[model samples]
Target: MATVAHEILSHIYSRIVSPQVKELRKYTAFSNNVYGELLPTFVSRIFKELELSSHQVFFDLGSGVGNCVLQAALETGCESYGCEIMENAAELADKQAVEFQERLKLWGIKAGSVTLITGDFLKIEEIGEILKKTNLVLVNNYAFDAELNGNLVNMFLDLREGTKIVSLKSFVPPGHNITAHNVESPINLLKVDEREFFTGSVSWTDAPGKYYISTIDRSRITKFLNSQE
Candidate 1:
């Protein structure tokens, strides 16, 4: 029944507003990338892997059209927030969010747990505070440039202990130049806990793409302190 509701919402959004996003495609060209929607199945699997709960807060950075955010809200009853840089995508997400709120009774989901913000996520003043409270953070940074990815890694450094961050791409590639940057690690205080590979549908493409899930290791601090002794 929950799966049916999820699919229904996906279909409704796609039928109503997916076509209008074409105007927004030009914006992605500047970044040498395109905004791709994740399949509901892939998102469902991710939520299952993480074991989200209503007690937790979830965030989807670079969230396009709020699919993952809405899904998380529906699946776990958790507070879900999504940040998208594109105006059209954000507007569409907000409109759909209103629809979701109106249909919450029919869907048997809680209200007021989803929010869609339109702007550069990096510029959000309270981003760090919000992330600190977040139990799970998801980022589809497959198209993000090195600068943006680096900034995102720095942002992760501010997260509370044991915060889980799942990304579609590695923030710190192998053999990153730490000496040149004068940072102990590519991500400063965060260490990759574990990485898992999965293939799933993205955007309108039928081909499945590989993704990575990583977490911030708070114990890295303790390990560092002990090494000094």
Candidate 2:
């Protein structure tokens, strides 16, 4: 089933998305923020790993061109949302989304609803509300600076328990110890697991790299508070 979905997504990208991107690139210059992409096959694997279902909600922060967002909707039938700050990338994402919907109809597939927003994800009020119920989030933060990543962590503090966040860079350091002085830190509420991906998993590089899945689990915080009592 996953293989078939991958084939279909590849076809859709080839037919509906690639041409639009090529045309857009001719007129627009993509900013450094608009750098990486999660390939269709890799994204499918991520959906499976995260156990995304029809009832779940998926969000892609800094979603470049909405490829991962479109794939999520088609593969899992989950409510999909993407926010891109780059104007040129956001414009292309909107065009790709329109074509993606049309192509889905042509293929006779029923996909989940897709919403693509153009703005700073941190400032988006709707995203804050959505995070409360979001099942999974993807952030390609390989090139993100420390300040931006810290801001993302602050925003993630609002995510409901059990929400899974996948990222190219780990939010919580390895063997992060929760202590009295920093017991209130957001990192205490997360359980992070690391995994590796081989070459061709992403658009930025050909070498193998690692990724992190941080699950929102406030049990650690609760346990710590209980211990204090």
Candidate 3:
């Protein structure tokens, strides 16, 4: 019954003013990378691979309008948190969170919840404390690319001890030197932990073409995160 209700509402929302927050509206006015919706099947597959717990807390980094957070929590039984840097985007995400929860309630889904944050994920004042309560983190791989991705990874590593990072990376360094640099930077900073990664190519609406998604293990990532703290 609840599932049916949520689907009805979601279908209606797809036709309404969703993803139309005051601030986010203007972003598309200039650059048009805003994805109001993604392929549900793809997202669901990715979420399953993330291995989220229904009772645990999940955080979405660079969470545009908070869709991922809402989806993960609603579908997986976890509490959801969305971190968006842009003010307008945050506002939109907040709106989405509220509506998603309401829709869930109408459909009879309970225990799951969602929250949104409007600030830099790297310097989100006192975020480490908040992250202490979280168990899973999702990085929209194409969202960071090669730019602030490193900093964000380091930040997530400093989060909770058992916190898992499931990032979608799209960059592959041309030279081993770049790889060495990523390897040595954290080591020199005196932070080291278990590290693992898987690399592959895929096409996303955000990237338009196939690109590499380099998955990093927690041990190696932990060293960098701990160092940043």
Quick one: ranking by TM-score, best first? 2, 1, 3
* TM-score of every candidate: 0.86, 0.91, 0.66
| TM-score of model 2 vs. true structure | 0.91
Estimate, for each residue in 91-137, the C-alpha lDDT of model 3 and write its tens digit: 66776666666666676766467778888777876567667787776
Error at 121, model 1, angstroms: 0.8
lDDT digits (tens) for residues 96-181 of candidate 1: 88777767766565633897888888999777778889989999887788889888888887787777787877775655433434
Q: Is 1 or 2 the stronger prediction by lDDT? A: 2
Please list the residue runs of candidate 3 whose C-alpha ends up more than 4 Å from where it truly belongs after superposition.
Answer: 1-9, 12-25, 28-38, 143-145, 160-162, 170-184, 187-229
List pairs with backbone clashes in candidate 2.
none
Regions of model 1 farther than 4 Å from truth: 30-33, 175-183, 186-188, 193-200
- Please give the ranking of all candidate structures by lDDT, highest first, separated by commas: 2, 1, 3
Which candidate leads the pack in lDDT? 2
Candidate 2 C-alpha lDDT tens digits along 153-197: 999989988999999998888778888898978778779999998
lDDT of candidates 1 onward, in order? 0.75, 0.84, 0.57
**Residue 58, model 3, lDDT:** 82
